[model samples]
Target: MPLLPALAVVLPLLLAAQTIEEQEWHLDALDVYSAQDQSRGDGVIVAVIDSGVDATHPDLAGRVLPGTGFGSSKGTDGTTDVDGHGTGMAGIIAANSRNGGALGIAPGAKILPIASADEKEQFALDVVAESIRWASDHGAKVINMSLGFSSSMTPSLVKAVNYAIEKDIVLVAATGNEGKEVSAPANIAGVIAVAGTNREGKPWKSSNVGTDTVLAAPAVSIVTTAPESVYSSGYAEMDGTSAASAIVSGVAALVRAKHPQMPAKDVVNALIKTAQDLADPGRDEATGFGMVNPMGALTAQFPPVARNPLLPEPKPSTTQPTPTLAAQQPVQPVVEMKDRLPFVAGVAGGTALMTGLLIALPAIRSRRREPVVSARDTPPTPW
Candidate 1:
């Protein structure tokens, strides 16, 4: 099946009359307005690698930069969207408040649209790899991959991803909508894998979950731009991890714009550290670190890291500094209780109840562990 079909498109009228604030619930959920006060992603180029993006759309008119198309999409530039998926993803990242239409998380960010697949979705893995390389070379600071494959990563794609990372490009991708293992590209190391969350901040039922997931964002009923042919209003409600990934990509753009001096590694660190924890607390497979908090990501204070945490640690060198007496001693791992306090408290309470049960066992022998029900135990009849 075409992965593009994974997203469900609602009626155009649903967004035709809705106000900007009313239509884009994700903005309020992530406190995008407050976050924008700090940075609107200006000077950041976010490349949307998917189907084509409709540049003519009111919300994305001038925000879309000239982009290229591959495979069957080569007939036109990456400006015409045959499938509305790319348009939706682009709007989520950089749509402006034109015609009172949908608003994006980083309205000032420019979208570098790369059409990897046409309407048939016949694009190969090599095409995706080529697109990544193109985006990296073309001044794209952040690349939004709202598409994925069920197959394993190709060698060429892996090299392309590494190339982008080496160039300090922030890669973000959706964790897929199959409710299975995270799809390739997103599952690849060093990529910010985004999962889906509903308006209530709970995990979206259809969102794929895995240890690779990096963050969750609003995916259900997300209002974004679409091709005019797809929706007369030039907008529609979308549902999938595709939208979630785009939302996180927008936040990454904001971070890049706000801290132009910050390296890609630090940008990734800031986003992961500032997210709001959800579900099982502290980096669970369902929600990763948690929902991507724009305000926190934009304004929160945190230490800078030496490297991207998503990538594997480098091997230790043979030559090492002479160990001091304190260094020779084993360093105790510091444990933060706030994350697991609830589970720890629950376990303690359960232990106390078990002890009480053991103490009362001798006195309660008269009662059966399981309630007995016999044919004679029928309810009493009315007079």
Candidate 2:
């Protein structure tokens, strides 16, 4: 069966048992309830780089920070969502359920919305790149890019991703929904590429799979906040790698909140190293390391520093040297180059003589040997 159809069949049944407050099954699946008791991603800013977020959404409320717009509607603040996609993503990361609204994975995290695209789903790489820089510059610790383009890595986008990495920003992006290879900037190095999993913990049929995919999250039939203008109820059920990326972003926020001084690479490593293996025993193309475990990621002991297995370990010094004899020696007077000219000339002459002898010896040996003329060479001369 097609993936969307199967999701449609499973969603209604799941929705039947869930009330408005309990609609966020992903949080329960990831065991976020327990993790939240420790840290709710307080003092961390997560940038949602997608179609603008609806700041007025009940669940979002004051959690949405002032955002900049990079879409066709220039200079407009990023509080408007024409497609409801960005709002859904933001709610997944930081929605407050205290008012009987949808619950977020990291309710205490602030959402910094950077609108870079529109309802047409058009993503300009330049705009996305600018938004990433803006987010990193604006104190965002975690940047979630739920939107993706079919094109492979773009130079500008890659530069922006690297810039974020340099700024100690943890970047999370959705592996595209084409069910083929993962897309950029998710496929870009250092970006946490997230894949979608259904409620059964199996890989979502439509979620793209590739070596780039680094994490999995509950994405199918996810209930999240939507824009009231677009989605009348301010809630909707959606399925895609986008939701998975947001969930992982929220988990990143939680990890960051716990370890405020953790570097971006180590923060990402904590999540992947502690993830629960799914499709395969270890890391696989379908599910990367495995489904993200928010509780495990939060409490898991991560190395204080990043370690790359591919890099050769530094060789330990085999011997300890005594104190430098030069330290105790008297300072020597500087010698003038003119005074050492004769010595330098002698060394240069010796080197030249040795080089000439080395070159002549081989030639002398060749001259001593008798040269044999080939029959073909003689015939060609005669011809």
Tell me the whole-model lDDT of each prediction, alpha carbons only: 0.74, 0.71
Tens-digit lDDT string for candidate 2 (1-383): 99999999987666554455576677777788899998899999999987788888777887999888886745877888876678888988998874456788899999998877644434566678899999999999999988665554556677777678778898998886667787767777678889888899999887788988899998776777777675456666666788899999999999899889888878888888889999658889989999999888888886566432111234345585432222222222432322211000000111112211101011100001111212221111100
Cα error, residue 282 of model 1, in Å, equals: 1.7
User: In candidate 1, what are the lDDT values of residues 130-188, reduced to their tens digit?
Assistant: 89999999999999987666556666677788888889999998887667777667877
- Model 2 residue 328 lDDT? 20
lDDT of 2 at 377: 15
Question: How many Å off is the CA of 296 in candidate 2?
Answer: 0.9
Alpha-carbon runs more than 4 Å astray in model 1: 1-17, 317-383
Backbone clashes under 3 angstroms, per model = 0, 0
